[model samples]
Target: MKAVVYEGPNVLTYKDVADVSPKANEVKLKVRACGICGSDVHGYLGITGRRIPPVIMGHEFSGEIVELGEGVNNLKPGDRVAAYPLDFCGSCEMCAKGDVHLCLNKRAFGVLDVDGAFAEYICVPAKVCFKLKDSVSYKVGSIMEPLAVSYRAVSHAGNLTGKNVLVVGTGTIGLLALSCVKAQNPRRIFVSDLSDSRLEIAKKMGADTVINPSKENSLDVIMDNTNNKGVDAVIEAVGVSATVKQSIDSLAFGGTAVWIGISDKHIDLEMQKIVTRELNVKGTFLYGFEEFRTVVEMLNEGKLNIDPILSKEITLEELPETMAQMAAGAGDIIKVTVVNND
Candidate 1:
C-alpha cells in the first residue's frame, strides 16, 4: 500500500506501507478519493492534540469495498461507499441516545487513536460504510463529511428560515454552512473572512454579503446589511480566539450563535452580551450517520453544489507540498483532494 504518512510538524511523506487487513465485522476499501480537511492541516502543523505522527492523514473519503471480514453480510465487494470516520461505543449513554459523537469512547479516523484513508486502501468497520450510487463519483462522495458537520450545526441551532444569519468564516466548512442554511432561505446571509478569494466563494455559495475584516470592516458591513440591526444568527466557523468574539458581536438581541469550529484553547466571552441580549451560543459536535446520509442525498439531488469549492486535486506524493500551501494560507486553495495513489 502507498500512503501519505505524517513525519512530524509540518512534514509529510508518501511511502509504501503494508496492506491493512480487516478485523471481524470490518471491510477493506480501495481508496479512490479523499478530501483534505482542516484537521489534517492542524495535525500537519502539530497544533491539534489528537493527531500523532507516523499515521495516515485523511478522513473525508470514499472508496470501493475490496474485501469484507466475517459477520459482514449487508455489503459485498465492489460497493461504492463513503467512510463514516466516527467510531463510537454503541453501549454508552450518548450512543444509546443516538448521539454517537458524544460517546465517551468515540474514535475518529485520522484524528485520534486510529489510522485513516490517504492511501491505496483503508480498513474500516463494516457498520460505517454507506453505499453511494454508481453515478456519484468518489470525489463527490468525499464531501459528505464536511457537509454533514454543517447539517448538524444548523439542526442543533433550531430554525433559520427568514432569519438573517452571519457566517463568521469563509473556509470550506463556512461555505458549506452558508449553502446549508440557504436551503431554509434565510432573509440574508453575511460571510466574513480575511481572504477575499474565500469570501468570493462564500458569496457564490449563497451568502448575500461578504466581509473582509482585514480590508474593510466586519462590524460595519454586517450592521449595514442588517438595516442597522444585528443578524438573527451568528455561526462561528473560525476556531481562533478573535473570531469567537466577532461571532458574539454579530448576534442580534435574541439571536443564536453556534460554534461549529474546533478551537485550540479557551477564549473569554462577554457574559454581559450573553445575558442582556439573551443571545444563545452553543457548540455543535459531529453528525450522526443519519444526518451524514441526508447530506449525501442533498448532494446527489443537486440541492448542494460543492464544485466551486474544490480548488485543486493532487496525487498522494504531492501532499507534502500542497498541504504546506494549505497550512500557510497560500494559493487559492479550497478543499484539496488526493485523486491518485502514490
Candidate 2:
C-alpha cells in the first residue's frame, strides 16, 4: 500500500507503507476519493496543532469496503461507503444527549489519535461507516463531511424560511453553508469574502449578493440591503477576529449568529450591544450523526448540487504540491479532492 505520510511542517512523502487491516469491530476500505480540507492545509503548515506529524491526514473521504471485520454484519465487502470520521463513546453524557460530536472521549480521523484516508487503504469502525447510494459518486460522497458541517451550522439558526442571512467567508465551508442556507428558502442570502474568485462562485452557489471586504464595506452593504436593520442571521465561517466582529455587527436585533470557524485569535466584543439587542450567539462545531446522515441522503437525492463547488481533482502523487498551494492560500480553488487511481 502507498500512503502520503506527513513527515513534518510542509513535508509530505508519498511512499509504500504497510497495508492496514480491520480490527474485530472495524472494516477496511480501499480509498476512492478524499478531499483536502482547510484544516489539512493548516496542519501541513504546522499552524494547527490538531494534526501531528507521521500521520496520514484526511478525514473527508469515500471508499469501497474490501474487508469486513469479524463481528461486522451490517455491511460486507464491495460495499461503497462514506464514514462519519468521529469515534465517540456512546455512553458519554454528550452522546446520550445526541451530541456525539462533543463526547468526552471523541477521536476524529486524520486528526488526534487516529490515522486517516490519505492512503490506498484504511480501516474505520464499522459503526461509523454509512453505505453510499449507487447514485452518489465517490467524489461526491467524500464531500459529505463538509456538507454536514455546513448543514449543522445552518441548523443552528433554526428555521430560515423567508429570513435574510449573511455568510462570512466564501471558503469551502462558507460556500457550502451558503448552499445549505439557501435550501431553507431564505428571503435573501449575502456572502462576504476577500477573494473575488470565491465571491463569484458564491454568486453561482445562490448568494443574492457577494461582497469583497477588501474593496467595499461589508457592513455597509448588509445595512443598505436590510434598510439599516442588519440581517436576521449571520454565519461566521472565516474564524478570524475581524470576521467574528463583522458577523456580530451585521446582525439585526434579536437575530441569531452561528460561529462555525475555529481560530485562536482573541476578539473583543461589545457586550452592551449584545445585551441591548438581545442577540443570540451560538458556536457550532462538527455535525452530529443525524446531520451527517441527512447530508448523505441529500447528496443521494440530488438536492444539493456540488458540481460548482468542486474546483479540482488530483492524484495521490500530487498531494504534496497541492497541499503547498493550499497552505499558501489558493484563493481560486474551492475544493480539491485526491482520487486514488491505483
Q: Identify the leading candidate in terms of TM-score.
A: 2
Q: By lDDT, who's the top model here?
A: 2
Total clashing pairs in model 1: 0
- Badly placed stretches (over 4 Å) of model 1 are 47-49, 240-242, 262-268
Question: Tens digits of per-residue lDDT for model 2 on 161-270?
Answer: 99999999887889889989888889999999888888888888899999998899999998999989999999999888889889888999999999998774577777
Clashing pairs in 1: none
Q: How accurate is candidate 1 locally (lDDT)?
A: 0.84
Cα miss at 104, model 2 (Å)? 3.8
lDDT of each: 0.84, 0.89
Measured with C-alpha atoms, the lDDT of residue 296 in candidate 2 is 83
Tell me the lDDT of candidate 2.
0.89
**Candidate 1 structure quality by residue, lDDT tens digits, 255-297:** 8989987765688777898999898889987778789878878
- Which residue pairs does candidate 2 place in steric collision? none
